[model samples]
Target: MANIQDSAQQLEEAIRNSDEFQNLKQAYETVMADEVAKKMFEDFRNTQIELQEKQMQGQEITEEEIEKARKVVETVQQHDQISKLMEQEQNLNVLINDISKTITKPLEELYGAQEQ
Candidate 1:
């Protein structure tokens, strides 16, 4: 367990230095430096979080909110920098998910992976 913890820390450091993380970080900085893009991104994120929270809380979100969120998404997707940031985010997410699967492979083998 101690060895695994040490390896985990090393893996985390490696991931931070990885191309995916570096690209994501650079893309994020580019988006944040543009005030208009930054504001747009923030609005999109806030709207998404609000909707997700409402769903999690079992609250019925109105059609207006859904339409507004859709518009926000559409507008943000039009910005090049914001779109690059989103793409980098997805790239990083894929890397993280792949790593997760690799780390959990042993457990899955031991318990037999179930078909979802």
Candidate 2:
């Protein structure tokens, strides 16, 4: 019937104009969910990059510190060797002075005996 058709058309038009409807709600929710997913993925990617950079920097600093420690060890070893050599030279000088004193003592004793 013509009346039924007209009523149905009016009902369709009213549904299209109404904002408090069920049909658009699903679409809006899907759009908002997509935006949230995009933002989360971006944040995750940025955090991963930042972490990687920090790890790289830490590795470089560790390597530098290791190298510095090696140099310090080498310097200490060199100084230790130098100290040993200096001690050996001082011992040799003391030995030479003892020999000179022993040789001069006999000469002085003979000279005193001749004078007496």
The candidate that wins on lDDT is 1
How would you encode candidate 1's per-residue C-alpha lDDT over 1-116 as one tens digit per residue? 46988999999999999999999999999999989999999999999999999999999999999999999999999999999999999999999999999999999987885654
- Kindly list the per-residue Cα lDDT of model 2 for residues 6-112, writing each as its tens digit: 87678667645554333344433443366654344344446446556767787443566456555544443355333343344455456557656764797878888
Overall local distance difference test of candidate 1: 0.95
Candidate 2: regions farther than 4 A off: 1-78, 110-116
Worst 10 residues of 1 by lDDT: 107-116
TM-score of each: 0.91, 0.26
RMSD values for the candidates in order, in angstroms, are: 2.4, 46.3
For model 1 the TM-score comes to 0.91
Cα error, residue 107 of model 2, in Å, equals 3.1
CA lDDT, every prediction? 0.95, 0.52
Model 1 superposed RMSD (Cα): 2.4
